[model samples]
Target: MTMGLPHGLDGTVEGREYLTFRIAQEEYGIDILKVREIRRYEAPTRIARTPAFIKGVVNLRGTIVPIVDLRMKLHQDCRPVYSEFTVVVILNLLDRVVGIVVDSVSDVLRLSDEQISDVPEFEGAIEVDSIEGLGTVGDRMLILLDIEKLMSNVDMGLVAADA
Candidate 1:
């Protein structure tokens, strides 16, 4: 089924769709609009001076796309084993295209405001600001992420300072 962002007559957002994925044992979701495509995992060309989480860059249809291991980036795992289930989630954020390695791609979920709650205070490697909200569907709880903000954070160094 196709899902699209819907707005109220007053111009307020009604609900949003998310592309959910797994990283280790935890489940996370990102704005579906930010997702370009999902591709099977492949070893990227290694680069020098880059962080370990950055697996390297891949040539995608002539465009060089840097691949970041989401497990390592989120500190869920220091070193993740790439199995057959591993996949790359290509995201187009702020006019830049980047890919994130995920354990597996789950499903696209449509969540309403009532289904999402504010994130509680926490201290961790992941900045709380990067978490958009917490979504609940049935018995499953999802960590909704503001991927653009996370990738643009100074430490990530994926986007320009002005971005």
Candidate 2:
């Protein structure tokens, strides 16, 4: 499913929409087009030997969707505690269906290209390439993520390495 984006006369996108959510104390945004649905948190059937971030898979209708905890995947300092606000954001990416666990879901904001700033150089473990950029709206700053690239990363083990 695709979310409409405003386009310029040259057939290029002028602005894009992002579905924002909170991982911990920080706000993050992902391409709205990639989002399928958001559901309340539920314990998924455990799959042994998988990485810690791979919470497990849930049977969504006939499709088994792997659930990844964004907090653990992002290496957040706090241990994840599922609460009333916790949710799963199902995503359709690279022809695969997956779910990501987050603290809460927020607004869908439309941002012009100029509203985004290039990710600054940092000395940390977070993969800089997975970050699309930092978006500013008023006093809020949203860390925009390239979710497709992140899920497709070799470390994720969600897809084939060559994919």
Candidate 3:
């Protein structure tokens, strides 16, 4: 299901499902369609010269997938203790497979167009462009992200140069 379409989308992002996960104290969401699978946290084979946020690579059924810590990339101060709750969200982005380390996955939430709101344009550690919108559910607010855009940018270095 569609997660974050551009803010000006014509109310068509309704009834979309998003995979919610926690990073620090904030909750974030990704399009369920991009999710390949969720695996328990594992120390990947360290790669030299890679960015500190890039946790390295892992062999997944013969395919080498690069892992990125979402918290570290976002500059969050949360303790990254790998445990049963910690997970690596495997995502298939633009035909490339990449994994993201998240604190804990919450649930698959269905959000309507009205439930999402545009984020004010402002520069931040993470690009404001990467944020799809903010979603509300009861008392919880989920920060919906444009996973494709975020992971395809120059900093992510996961997708191809022109992807």
Candidate 4:
């Protein structure tokens, strides 16, 4: 991991590492530094009255961590079966730990300034304000996400609104 202004800042993006994951037909990436570990899909304990996307909690080495399904949260058609590709990405956000279920995790990419582009305004879950930017690697375009913002967004219902 090299250096880039904290969340898609400046005109340049350099050497920052990102962990890529797939949800629905789209590909997304998040900062590798925030990731704690990756675990296989395990049926988490259900907590009543929470949003469907909030898949409840799991015990990771005795620490209970909330699990959120990115696929369901973003309104994507989920697979009826949880296969080997299904994974839970454990992330540490603002000192609190949480897990996000994703279709599959690809690889860690190191991008330079030229490989990245600023986020353009879009009307959807993957939008300018919620994303870090677009990263280009080879012929593939990766939607780099500002995971912190996406997780903390009002619609996500993970954190309380400041209103």
Q: Highest TM-score among the candidates is held by which one?
A: 1
The regions of model 1 sitting more than 4 angstroms off are 1-13
Task: Look at candidate 1 and tell me the lDDT of residue 103.
Answer: 97
Query: What C-alpha lDDT does candidate 3 achieve relative to the native structure?
Result: 0.88
Tens-place lDDT digits, model 4, residues 13-90: 447889999987888899999999999999899999987888899989989999999888776555435788999999
Q: Across residues 25-70, which tens digit of lDDT does each residue of candidate 2 receive?
A: 8899999999999999999998999888899999999999999998
lDDT (C-alpha, whole model) for all candidates: 0.90, 0.90, 0.88, 0.83
* lDDT string, candidate 3, 63-150, tens digits: 9999999888887454467878999999999999999999999999988788899998787777898899999988999999998888
Q: What is the lDDT of residue 105 in candidate 4?
A: 98
| Candidate 1 worst ten-residue window by lDDT | 1-10
Taking the candidates one at a time, how many backbone clashes does each contain? 0, 0, 0, 0
Model 4 quality (TM-score): 0.84
Please state every model's RMSD to the true fold in angstroms. Answer: 3.2, 3.7, 4.8, 4.9
Descending-TM-score candidate ranking: 1, 2, 3, 4
